[model samples]
Target: MKQRPAVDLSELPTFGHGPRTPTWWGTLAFMALEGMGFAIAAGSYLYLAYLTPQRPLSAPTPNHWPGTIVTLLLLASLVPNHILKRHAEACEMLPVRIGLVVMSLLGIAPLVVRWFEFPALNIYWDTNAYGSMLWVMLGLHTAHLITDVGDTLVLTALMFTRHANSGRRFADVGDNVFYWDFVVVTWIPIYLLIYWMPRLD
Candidate 1:
């Protein structure tokens, strides 16, 4: 057989350019919107507090203890979530999975505690202006938390499957972690406003 020169593979064109991937731009835009939403809600809570002559009504004073517990759990979840996000970006699956599971549990446990805690406060959405504001703020956050838990669960499942092998896995996990961090970061000020602040007197 005659000797033949090897063709350079790098010169060949690959299949049509791969499909476009999702970028963090959309996620950043979403976060901006969410930040505005929280700011408006928090402003409303403060405004309502200011408008009332007897703000932070003595009769409907919020209990600090329950809020304290919830705050602790939310604050704690941040650690694992941060770790998992870093790990996911590095394509380290085991730690990401462990962190996701821990983060999910930490995220949900507070809501469960709040379930019992909210009713015990004996304040209804219609009870008073303060009551209404508190409910609206907490309710909005709770909705976010619910969505976060679902997203984390989905990510956890994907981490264990072949789907995670796709190129977009990093983006998916990254976005989820970013959102989770948003939830945790946003809650800090909210906790201060709702839990630590002295009741309107």
Candidate 2:
């Protein structure tokens, strides 16, 4: 019996970055499901607003400041987020470490600003359909923010330890950046809906 020569497999890298990694695809699929959720919620809000006599149902237009501030912060964070991703891709320990620490803090800043944002709404979630939808949308985004920030914090902590040496860790950092971009980008529409919709004729 002639057995074929077995191919040597040792030359291949154990892991990869971006699409080469399973985690990246999983993150993408997760984002698709989440994006659908956001779309449905946003659609429902529009339907309710269209059916109502008054768009906000007598609630004053929400103060745009807090949400606006959060928006600005999220937008601003992109700079450092990409920087982190870049360093992570290169597996550069120092900048990746610095970026993660900075990201951890940047992540918290919005959550903190978001606290003020809910109050700025000037309407309780239970108040009416508009209020409920607004809160639901905002809450959805807040949940994402919290999730990503927590993940980033954990990764940041891990990056400081001996465990940071692996390419897998840097790949995780890159994925965190990808998810953070989603979180930040999703907020723009939510922001417009929450803050600007009430004022529209």
Candidate 3:
């Protein structure tokens, strides 16, 4: 038999280096699209508000207490999520597990509260222009949150299985966290518009 050369694992790159870490370009592109969506929605709301002189049909308007609490929960998730990304980059398992658990809890809590709020508010999609805008905006954001939770879960599993020890894992975690951050940050303006602005006017 002819002798064959042995392959050395050390010779291979620890991680593929072509725009590592979730591809910044891809993340930016997605963010751009999301931003445009939010902008258009906000514009529509403002246009409708301007046309409607009545401004909030009833007094003692919808209480924003629930939304505020949800917002706080979502905002709090950012810290642990960021820490998880950092720990992943350092190839530390403990912090990554802790961070993932925290992030998942943070992401899921707001969604549950949101579901509860919908019924208590006793509003419909066509209740008024405000209702329509509120549903669409919150619905869109909620969709993003659902996706984020799924992504985080996948990452968590990878970490648990020791499949994320590759150099690329850091990039993956970083990328997911970046998108998750965008999802939360984007909600701030929408929250202000939907919950606070109505009360002020």
Best by lDDT: 2
**Which wins on TM-score, candidate 1 or candidate 3?**
3
Candidate 3: pairs in clash: 21-171
The positional error of residue 76 in candidate 2, measured at the CA in angstroms, is 0.7
Give the Å error, residue 131, model 2. Answer: 0.9
Score residue 91 of candidate 1 by CA lDDT. Answer: 69
Each candidate structure's TM-score, on Cα atoms with residue i matched to residue i, is 0.82, 0.97, 0.85
Model 2 Cα lDDT, one tens digit per residue, 1-201: 998889899999877789999999999999999999999999999899889966678888899999999999999999999988889888899999999999999999999999999989999999988889989999999999999999999998998899998879999999999999999999999999988878775
Question: Which candidate should be chosen as best, given TM-score against the real structure?
Answer: 2
By the lDDT metric, which is better: model 2 or model 3?
2
Residue pairs that clash (backbone atoms under 3 angstroms), model 1: 55-200, 56-200
| TM-score ranking from best candidate downward | 2, 3, 1
Candidate 1 TM-score over all chains jointly = 0.82
| Runs in model 2 lying further than 4 Å from the true structure | none
Query: lDDT (CA) for every model shown?
Result: 0.74, 0.93, 0.77
Q: Per-residue lDDT for 1-201 in model 3, tens only?
A: 999998878886665322553386688788899889998989888888898777664433556777888889888888887787778667677887778878878888988888865553446668877777777887888888898889888877887785765667666777888888899899899889877777678
lDDT of 1 by residue, 43-155 (tens): 99888777766657654566777777877888787777778778866767777778777877887798887786576455787877777878877887888889888887787
RMSD of 2: 1.0
